[model samples]
Target: MTDTTAIDIPGYKQGTWVLDPAHSEVGFSVRHMMISKVRGAFGVKSATLVAPENPLETTVTAQVDATSLDTKDEGRDGHLRSADFFDVENHPTIDFVSTGVRIEGGDFLVDGDLTIRGVTKPVTFDFDFGGFGADPWGNYKAGATAKTVINREDFGLTWNAALETGGVLVGKDVTITLDLQGALQA
Candidate 1:
């Protein structure tokens, strides 16, 4: 990516920004056993944001290795990688490609298609701009947050167990959150 510092892109920096994985995180939480929530983070991934000449035409893409899911529990993470869940051997990556972007209520609404387990669905994330600045290392940096919720079943991640408590072991809904930090590249 080329460092773009001469122009300012709407809702982002002037040029392409490469995701700093060490400073960014992709995480999720879902109700478990109908009583509590299970939270986890995918610590491995790659993402990029391209700010076009027309700032409003910006685009973004991301890929998450399904096998990197870490719920902090060895057994559950192993299960999540099996055929009953992500089936990492078959569908190793979950991906997202933005289709459109617009400002709404002072925030950026990014509309995109998210793919998981070979299933794709339209989703929109509320994007929060964290502004652009210079890091201590003298590199220009940009930061933001994206958040959304999706139905696990919609993405073919419907595996679950029934609880005698009248609810399923895992909730259908999953909340995803992304904290993004990027460095301007040239």
Candidate 2:
């Protein structure tokens, strides 16, 4: 087994960072039934990462376009945007604002409030440091990944169809993954 403590990169100066939307992705995966899994991604409209003097207390705020959701299948994507799910017409964006952040050994934890369909709930995402580097354009870039599992029904997204086999059409738990790339703002 690999030691996670060795994965951390050196911390940078305290400052604000802007997410590189072109390289960052917010995606999710969930069981389609009792067997298969379905996946989708939402476009990141804007994001800001606020690194405190002590990197461990970093803060992240992001807004995702609800209508920009895309999956491999158009029909399924349409359904996800409907009232049965996200109801894109009503909730035009999905937002997250971090409340607390901390680092334990080599791993980081980002605790935040996630709002969906007007319902707000506290959620924690495990953050993995991906180090900071310079881009080809001379921009200072930083990379990281965060993941968490949330119950769809907990946010008022309880719509579902009973499967003939005995399970529901949609899975209750959704695995959210975030691959983020940020550029420090001088």
Candidate 3:
């Protein structure tokens, strides 16, 4: 549980904040071949934060364009968008809706439901605030980074190939990260 009274955001305000998609990113990294890691990012189709007087009471929702996945390899990217993985044609977007927020020690934990390929699971992202400020045009902005890890199988992403040496083509766990920036709405 979070002691909302203990949470003090310096420049916080109560209002709706819209994501600055141009400055925001939703990325993931997964273990490849039981060795190195492969990283990729998806386009943030939309996101919004409804901040109340108490930041802990804020609610967040975001949609990620799964079809926009890019890993710098065309073939791999195409495969990821196929039914074997994200199934972008059938499940075009990965969505998230916050359920709760809490403070643990010096960090914030955002609890939410993450849906992928029609499978929904609870996840907690360790959130780090990047402070609030104003841009050159005087639009109040806020920046943050949050991350969590999940098992690909849990999301129905069970496709894999076995190597001759006994290892699998892909690892089970995946790390999801969000680099977010939003502007406070008038």
> Top model by TM-score, which number?
3
lDDT of 1 by residue, 1-186 (tens): 223233354445568888999998889999999889999988648888898676657789999878889999999999999999999999998999999887765566888999999999999999887888888888888888999999999988888888786979999999999989988887
TM values, all candidates: 0.91, 0.92, 0.97
For residues 1-186, could you state the per-residue lDDT of candidate 2 as single tens digits?
A: 323232334756568999988999999999988799898999999999897666656788999988999988999999899998999999989999998776665567888999988889999999887888888988898888999999999998999989998998899999999999999998
Two-way lDDT contest, 1 vs 2, winner: 2
lDDT of 3: 0.93
For candidate 3, the TM-score is 0.97
Number of colliding residue pairs in model 1: 4
On the 0 to 100 scale, the lDDT of residue 65 in model 1 is: 76
Evaluate all candidate structures by whole-model CA lDDT and list the values in order: 0.86, 0.87, 0.93
Q: Candidate 1 regions off by >4 Å?
A: 1-12
* TM-score ranking from best candidate downward: 3, 2, 1
TM-score of 2: 0.92
Location of the lowest summed lDDT over 10 successive residues in candidate 2: 1-10
Model 1 TM-score relative to the real fold: 0.91
Task: Look at candidate 3 and give me any clashing residue pairs.
Answer: none
lDDT of 3 by residue, 1-186 (tens): 455664678888789999999999999999888889999999999999999888888899999999999999999999999999999999999999999888878778899999999999999999988999999998999999999999999999999999888899899999999999999998
* Candidate 1: Cα lDDT at 149: 99
